[model samples]
Target chain A: MKGVVFVKLSEFVEETWGLALWDELLQEADLASDGIYTTVCVYDDQEFFSLVSLIGNKKGITVAQAQKAFGEWIFTELYAIAPPGAHDFVDIFEFLHGVQNVIHVEVKKLNPDGLLPEFDFLFESEKTLRFHYKSPRKLCYFCEGLIYGLSKHVNQEVTVSHVECEHNNDDRCVLEVSKVG
Target chain B: MDKNPPPEALDIQLLKRKIEREQKARQIAEQQLEVHSREIYQTNLSLKKSLDYAKKKNAEIEYLTKASYDVSSELTLFDILQSTVALTGRFFNAAHGINAIFDGQKVQPNSKPLIWSSGGFWDQNIELQSFFFKHFPLERAGAPPEWLIMPIDENDRIEGQSFRWIVCINFELGNDSSVWIGFLSKSELIDEEALNVLEIAKGHLRSGIRRRLSDARTVRRNIELQETATHLEDARKQLIQSERMASLGELAAGVAHEINNPIGYIRANLQVLDDYLKEFKSTFKLIEEKVNLTGSLSKQEFTDTANKQDLNFLLEDAESILKSNLEGVERVKEIVEGLKSFSHAGDDNLKQISIYECVGTALRVVANEFKYQHQIINELEKTLPNILSNYGQLQQVFVNLLINSAHSMPDGGTLKIYSELSGKNLLIHVEDTGVGMDEQTKNQIFNPFFTTKPVGKGTGLGLSVTYAILEAQHISIVVDSTLGKGTCFTLGFTVD
Candidate 1:
């Protein structure tokens, strides 16, 4: 896991629950860095799962729901961290489309060894965009949260749905996002 | 203790449930962590791909920049085309690439293309060449634009292989000049970046080809000008020679007529003198006979008188002297006559006459010139019909040809003259058994002032004049000759 994601999660937990819960979860997880994280360094992904699960249990929510919420929170955080020029996206469709060709490519430039999910834009129309998502991490719900987060960031009204889900034994997850009038 | 133990029992059961819950939570967290770890690994793989693609695109841009510079700087069109083909192959990862220019002359579908390809495959494939020529427009109206894309037919393929993608970029240089760059792949579809590279390369190709065409035109124009100048100089020389020949002919005709009068008197006077000599000899014989009968003097006295006069020798040699003189005068007359016939000008009357008669007259005119050295054999067909033509000019032409034949054989040889009636024409052949001319000589044999004879011996105008006269009469002449074998001059005259 990227240290940035971990940092964001820690911030999210500290803001939602409390700073003491964040500290206690880190200690319980027994991370390699002993609860210290930076935006640039890499960390074990297990620590992230442990922390999120603990947070989920404390809040009486499912693990998937916690992951989805974290995904939405990270989206807004990425938008804030992005350069001002990144705000030029016209709508959620534009922002989501850029994820594969533009955003992920830039990410690779920033971190030469960084990993990113594969996104293939299947089709596009005036009010709709569809893509196939393939990743080893079965995070289809997280991708769905990103689409909704894109809509929120662009201040646009849109509906995003999954026509195919890898969790349901599909080869890949297929997202169909449509713009609202 | 069995019925209602302390509250500690209920608390201990709740604690066990709590511990089980914690264990279940840890298992789920571990599974999710595994998924997240896989996701990171996949994302890294994707990142590597992105970097490679970026590197490929960067290399493409660098090559394109270099190609642009090379195209503009290359001195020749061939170099530019070669570079373009090489770069295009690299850009598209093409299996086959060709850069071609349409040479101006022929562009038939089967015509050889002016192409440069990376491999020898295109040169070996005739069907591919045909396909290219059939599709490419060698000539167009208002000129084809700088760039065009030619689509390949889905059903069309090459070299027993199917190509799903083939892109042809035609870069037109003005004035029906253009270059075509083609990239072909069997499986890989050309992407947007490749198309972009092609578009950029076209401008360079166009300018390079344009410069080449301009240079070619300039060189061609220079050659044309040089050729025109040479032709004009030749025409001037021919005109001067023609005028000089015309003036010489007029002078010759006047001299011939003036000489004809004296030749006539000299020939008549020689005949009279020969007759008088014959009379004198007979009178002497009669006197001798009378003297013998009368026996007026002794035999010694008569013999002495005869010896003193040298009468026997005089009688024998004097006749031959007069005959030789007559022959000389006759030769002079014939020469004057030949000169007059050759110089004869003006459109004379057309007379319906047998060609045999003309050949006979020509033979008589040139007989003394060749009779002693060559035998003249005539194979004229008596059944041949007469033709309406200028008798005098035809006789002159024949006379000149016979004289030429005579001159060809300084030693004894046969001069064969024959005629045959072909379809609507009379074909006359004058063949000689003499040393014939070579190819070069035969080619220039009828050119004015061109001759193989020595400077003083020949005017070099005989055959040329003959050619002019025959041409004026609408007759065609052909010469077939082999060195050391013979020459045959065939003349065709339309018979009406």
Candidate 2:
């Protein structure tokens, strides 16, 4: 797991639930970092799972649902921080495309040991793009939320559909995107 | 009240179930949003690559336009190659380069490569040229592609040198004319954009070579046309001169014939008048004798009549005057005949005749000119075979030579005419023992309008016309002379 993910999760929790709930989630997670994170550092994947699970249990929602909500909330938070090599694109599509190449390349330079997912894209049409998401973490739902957040930032309406999911016995997650409005 | 209220507990359980369903729905929605973001990100990466490729291609095209303009502006091969090298270096960031022409032969190892380099000439290791020819084999293949890029080994570098790349391009200018441009640089590797630019530069070099060759061909053709025009103009002038000389010969022959007829009658009438006067003197002397026998007239009267008539002086001078008059007419007749022969020689038929015999005939024709002052010697080669030649023209040439030989000596001298067979040629030599010409005079002796004779006494055309005649017959003449010694004119005629 990357420290950026942990830091984004903490911000989302504190903003949506409140400071007390964030402290409670940190105490429950028992991370060695004690819930503190820097975007350039790497963290254990187990810590991220523990925090998501605690949030789900306290909110009476499933762990998968918590991760998806976190995905959506974290994108808006990441934009606010506006790190170098990010938030410089004019279009949602441009921003989204930079995630794997430009933005993630910068990320690896900052945190070389962090695990990053592989994304392979096939442009389906003028208004549609499709990609296969591969990672052992199976965070396809989180990727879906990031797409929506980007579209919202650019004030464009788009649909993100799951063609296949790793949970359904697929080797990799596949997603499709199309402009709706 | 009980520890837990029944109504509140039921309401809390219902609220938890509703929230669970709503949360599951929200999860699905958020997942879709994430998927779309990833898809757009992937697409943008692909688009960026495409955009970069397009930009690179556009820049290459621009380089091609500029290179083409620079190269084609020059009209010579070396100029074209120099410009090509400069542009290629600039485009590829090359430090040194060679633009060579191999003449499509087996390249020699020691041969120097034609090059234009930024840092001045470095003795390129001969191994490099050999290696280039070995791989490219431009001898068999006229051109080595329009564009090529490859790496030069760092280990192949000369002492302290650091270039690591080589790019070669070929331009075929037709007729096995080809130019090769090779660029060398210290850069580690050339990118695809620079390679693409090299391809376009190759195109520019090709057209530049083609245009220069075309211009050179045009210039050569123009020179040939001008030469042909000059030759035609020269031939026209020669034709006009020939026609004028032909007409002058006809007029001279006509005048000689007309003068010869009158000279013939004048000599005969003068002889008849001399004979009749001698008869009259004899009859007068006999009548005087008969009168003296009869004693009819006094001696004094007879003597007075004889003296008044001047009979003795008339008797002495009458025969002498007639003989001198006849000799004058004969000399005029001989000169008229010589003029006629010389002028009408153009009409004489060609035949196989001994060149020696022609010299004999010429000696007789001009015997009068030499008989007075010079001894004529004939050393004709008797073993010489007959040659096919114009008899009258050969005679004329010999006659002119004999006359010139006679005029050389005011005092008596020897004139020797001889002939020999040398190879396939008949060589005739005319030697004179009279005053020869100086070096300056000998050089211009064969030129028209050049004569040693006082003006009006000579036309200066004798030797000049003889030269023209021999030249027309493909005969060569050489005059060897030394002042105060003698002149020898050697005529060589090819005999087949």
Tens-digit lDDT string for candidate 1 (A16-121): 8766567667657777655566554578877777788887887899876788788877788887876445667776777776676677777777777876788889
RMSD of each: 26.6, 24.0
The TM-score each candidate achieves on chain A is 0.87, 0.85
Across residues B6-56, which tens digit of lDDT does each residue of candidate 1 receive? Answer: 668755654564455346545645666787799889999999999999998
Residue B237 local lDDT, model 1: 40
lDDT of 2 by residue, B1-496 (tens): 7877686675666445435534653564466567767877998998999999887676667668777777757546776677667766766677766766655654433445655467555456565555455445365447455566667665666567676766777766566655677776778767776776676666667667777788889999999999998897566435424433442353345445445545665666566667757765775776588587886767776666666666666666666666666766766665556545444535434568788767765664565565455777898876678887777677667776777888897788988877777788778899998899988998897777688888655567677767766776677899998888889999987787
What is the alpha-carbon lDDT for the whole of candidate 2?
Answer: 0.70
The residue ranges of model 2 lying beyond 4 angstroms of the native Cα positions read A1-181, B1-75, B108-111, B120-140, B143-145, B153-162, B173-177, B195-197, B230-234, B241-255, B259-496
Indicate the docking level reached by candidate 1: incorrect
Native-interface RMSD of candidate 2: 11.7
lDDT of 2 by residue, A24-114 (tens): 7766777776665655446788888889889999999987678778887777877776558786797766776788878878868855766
Alpha carbon lDDT of residue A144, candidate 2?
83
